[model samples]
Target: MDANDFVEIDGSYLEGGGQALRNALSLSCILGKPVRVVKIRANRPNPGLSHQHLHGLDLLRDITNADVVGNVLLSTKVEFTPRTILDNTYRVDTRTAASITLIYQMALPVLLFAGRSSRLIVSGGTNVAFAPPVEYMQQVLLPNLKRFGAGFELKVQQYGFYPRGKGTCQLDVQPVAKLNAGQFMDFGRINLVSGVGFCAGRLPVNIAIDMQQTAQREIHRLWPEQECTIETVKHSPEKTRDNGAGILMTANTTGGVVLGASALGKKRIDGHVLGSEASCQLAEYMRKEICVDDYMQDQLIIYMALAVGRSRMRTGRLTKHTRTAIHVAEQMTGVKFDVTVEPGGQTLVTCEGLGQLNKLI
Candidate 1:
């Protein structure tokens, strides 16, 4: 399928929410494919684009000079056709404090595909609900992507939490001619694993201290020899409306595989629970004996499609989000996908017809 062939997606098909829509839109922009989305998150309370979604859409429109028509509202369907993206530093501001990570997710793929390097400065919520915190991006995703020859730098100028969203981050991206595939089948030996707790806003300093102490003790119990650290940041009264905390754990493998897990603060949240949950999540990934996480599985599909060679990954589960991503990818590149479900609930995803698909796209 070339850029001329229009594709249609039932946005409410699976997971039945904005994520489906976001994935569809992002693929359209990255591949310069035109897409028509129907049943647009039909089950959602406010089914269409929220301010964050619209902001992401607007940023794409500005970057690719795409032709978009339809209501940029909650649950509304949209048709987008990306022309060619421009290469330069772009600035985007999400008026409402939406998750900046969502914006980064949508735009990063397109920027990577751009003919020239690009830089971006975005202002808005950096730490928000239902999204990866800034720490996750800096510590986990970006570093892992570097293994595949992806290189980018992110600088957080401020911490933005919920309600009162005022934060800033700058990104520098250097596009690569082609990506190198890597493997992570075994976690090797556990070198070090630790947890960090960060708190902001009206949060009491004692809360951060208590959470850190609790998390550190749990980490010590799990790996007695591992080292840990905790930190807290207090926000000026004028900068925040509420309290927030984030817990992150990083595990180093003997063979150099670095895996990260994280949990965020919520009302009545227990620090021990947060630490244990993050630790367990990392352990589960290691147990799966796979190289990629569920999130990376979905994120890397597009890169695999664009790569010059075959790429494969073994993941814990094929979530609806993963399925949606694969569907969108096939539509964009017309590359037939081979997905096998293992007996123990793991999934093997592979793409072999890359050379031919690259010609088509």
Candidate 2:
């Protein structure tokens, strides 16, 4: 297809961040439509493609055998033309502290429609600043995706942090003929609260243990009947590029909702504060009475737009990231989305999916 035939997406459309680029990539591959994104990441400092963004685009190029232009680092515009989707095992090493979770998001939606199972080995920052930690993907997001009939497994081989990222993780995804539309309208009663406290690279295990205890205590104090399980993780210093500690906590509800919050440990940072902040975030989410948190709402937009039926979700609020994702998905797939503000100031997002097919040749 000629570049003129591709959908033209202005990178400055909404939040003007890397999210628009990532959404364009996934939608292009899924719909077999080429896309040209201009002014990429125009709103961020040092705007244009970074190592992490390039890594994601390169992986998409490899998987779909796509012709990609303007993929060089710090480029402000790019064109992606996907010819085919290949189902195969792939390995990607970001070789820096880039967020592996973002990389996974770039790959997952398109891979599910690849007509065969795909396995991915991605190594980079697992728990880092400005990204969703691996635990959130495993504990919260994956389970919710499973409710919509997506099947995938993630295994962490090592922990990594900012500046010196050496984390390793594996994802195995089974392709689906069509994705089921998700309905997340109710965040029912709280049932279980659990989490993992981890440290690596010269950090003592005691730090993880103490963090876990503090988080558990906070949860217990808030809801005396609520059970919070804390798992302490000790990773080898040799496996990580630098020292780091963090905690990720989740609250699972009877209405099949999962809310997650995390805190990163820093030099001279107080562990108790980290734990308290994590637990408090989870509590705040529960009080909001929405099924999806702010981040998950953005993450689910693409999937909902691609599913087989009308999908509906109630989120705490509409963020610029989520708005940008909706716009990009609509532009690429020609899918229509309806977003409205409810009485309590929460946002309700709904869409009818394109219902694309996945079949092995």
> Model 2's lDDT to the true fold?
0.87
Local error of candidate 2 at residue 254 (angstroms):
1.1
User: Tens digit of lDDT per residue, candidate 1, span 120-145?
Assistant: 88878887777877787887778677
Model 1 residue 12 CA deviation (Å) reads 1.3
Candidate 2, residues 102-165: lDDT per residue as tens digits?
9999999888988778999998999888889998899889987986789689998887888878
Report the Cα lDDT for candidate 1: 0.72
Superposed Cα deviation of residue 211, candidate 2 (Å): 2.4
Local distance difference test, each candidate: 0.72, 0.87
Candidate 1 has which clashing residue pairs, if any?
47-74, 47-75, 48-74, 48-75, 49-73, 49-74
Show where candidate 1 strays beyond 4 Å.
1-4, 224-242, 343-345, 353-361
Best by lDDT: 2
